[model samples]
Target: MTQLADQRPIAAAQEAAVDPAVNSSSTTTSAAELEQLRRARPRGPHRRSPLAQVGVRLALALVAVVALAPVAFLVSLSVRSTDDVLTGSWLPGGFGELAWGNWSAAFRTIPLAHMLANSWLVALGSALVTAVVAVPGAYVTARAGKRGARLSAALLAGYCAPPVVAVLPLFFLLKEVGLTNSVVGLALVNGLANAPVAVWLLDSFVRRVPVELEEAAWLDGLSVAGGLRRIVLPLIAPGLVAALLVCTFLAYGEFLFAVSFAQTTASQPLTVGLSLFQGDRTVQFGQQAAAALVGVVPVYVLAVVAQRWLVGGLSQGALK
Candidate 1:
């Protein structure tokens, strides 16, 4: 045993002679080398130089300012007096002295509250209709492979065509059904018009869903519809919300169809009702701007509220 112990020291010495790093402790030496390697590694692409980062930030700030300039101008117009509007000054006067009566004047000129309600109804209806048509269609197309691609292309091609071409046909169709000059009628038209867009938006989202999930669902005794409802719908909810919001915005801003279908104050949405601000003799510029600003509020609020889902839906298929 004594000789064996003496030989252990000899073995240790030989090992230390061969590898000095292992003489102290292998773990400690390996950790040190790892740290050194980490320090020597190159920075990632996102780690920009200070000057380059500053320039990029400045450029982004400039773009944001340019994009928001029109909205700021619209706000300025909304607060202007009739005389200031006629003068065409960017700002009516000192900010504190600017007229605040335009908002009230807009409400007075037309049933602004009622028009806003009509617009909301149409927008909500259009979104609902779009979701109903788009979700099933998108899912089917996404799973259909090349045939689905052709169908999606065809739908988008129809969307690319001018809405004007179908205006007369749509008008006659609605009239035949006794739906002309009604908000419901207008909502139906807008919903069908925007369905193609919604389907296109949702196709990628549906495709991102793994076939394995549906296969598992089937193993669990779920039918195709059950799998869609139980698994796919929940997974693609963000995309659905995004598509609905887009359809709502499209319906809200729709003009040609709104003008043709909804003629009365009860049925007319904000887009068509805004025309009342224009007279044969002159335009009620301040009132128009005020109403326009009011009309814009819902859009902004929706964007802010749904910001997360919107971004998520858009980027759903980007990474995974």
Candidate 2:
């Protein structure tokens, strides 16, 4: 009986150990099954109903139509005759009725070629100047720590001040320097005006460059300028392109300064020259539209070409 009792206890212990191992095995299997089921479950896209997908697509289509409507109208109006435009037709007339002569007439009526050349010079020059000034300023400010922050803040303050407030002062200064009514003068003014914005934009891009790369260059005996040229410029090429395009667009579309400063046809840009289509009695709507279209083409082309870089640069800066 004693031997039997000992044997019973031994059996009980073995069963206990076996029960735990079995339980553990079952639990692990259950956990793995649960994980598998989770992975197999339908995701977000699969959960969306056909109706919901249709609704989303329809909403996007509607938004696109609404946004493009004005542009379509402007293009249609540009190709129409004055009579057709005056008749308030929303849709353009027949192909035969299209006033192709309006384009020729628009250029002939004003010094369109000269104005275009002047605008290009001012826009490109301002963009170049802004890039030259802003890149150095941004690099210096970004590397200067707290001093850089203070300097950047000061620039922002200057930029925040209304341009109109300083227009008269700037005009007088340009007049004194014999730069008034000249494309070069307008470019310089535009460049100065946009310098702060360029700095703000480039500051973000400059700071994004890895300090390790610059430090490596320094260790190799590269000067700051050399480091920037070798390491920084290539990295920030997109940001530079974005900034240049923005500066060009701003200078190209600038009407207030062009009108205020450039009085003569010889120096007038397209923005000011477009106003020549306006008569004291009645506006030549078709011809004005044609001129406006001509002026907008270059900007539109630039926007399309640099759109990816522009969006990426702006978003990257904003995120930083």
Question: Which candidate has the top score in lDDT?
Answer: 1
- For residues 1-320, what per-residue lDDT tens digits would candidate 2 score against the true structure? 99999899789778868799876887899999999999898879767888999999999999989966767777887788878888987867799998888888888899888998899999999998898898889898888878997898899799888779888998999999998889989999999888888888888888888889999999999999999888998888878888888888889988888888898899999999988888898787777888887777777787878889999878877666
Model 2 clash number? 0
TM-score of each: 0.86, 0.79
lDDT against the true structure, each candidate = 0.88, 0.86
Most accurate candidate by TM-score: 1
Q: Relative to the unseen true structure, what is the C-alpha lDDT of residue 64 in candidate 2, on a scale of 0 to 100?
A: 82
Q: Could you tell me which residue pairs clash in candidate 2? A: none
Off by over 4 Å in 1: 1-13, 17-36, 40-48, 95-97, 219-221
Candidate 1 Cα deviation (angstroms), residue 36: 5.6
Residue ranges of candidate 2 with Cα displaced over 4 Å: 1-56, 81-89, 92-100
Over 209-292, each residue of candidate 1 has an lDDT whose tens digit, in order, gives 999999998998999989888899998898898888878888999999998878788899999888989889988787898999
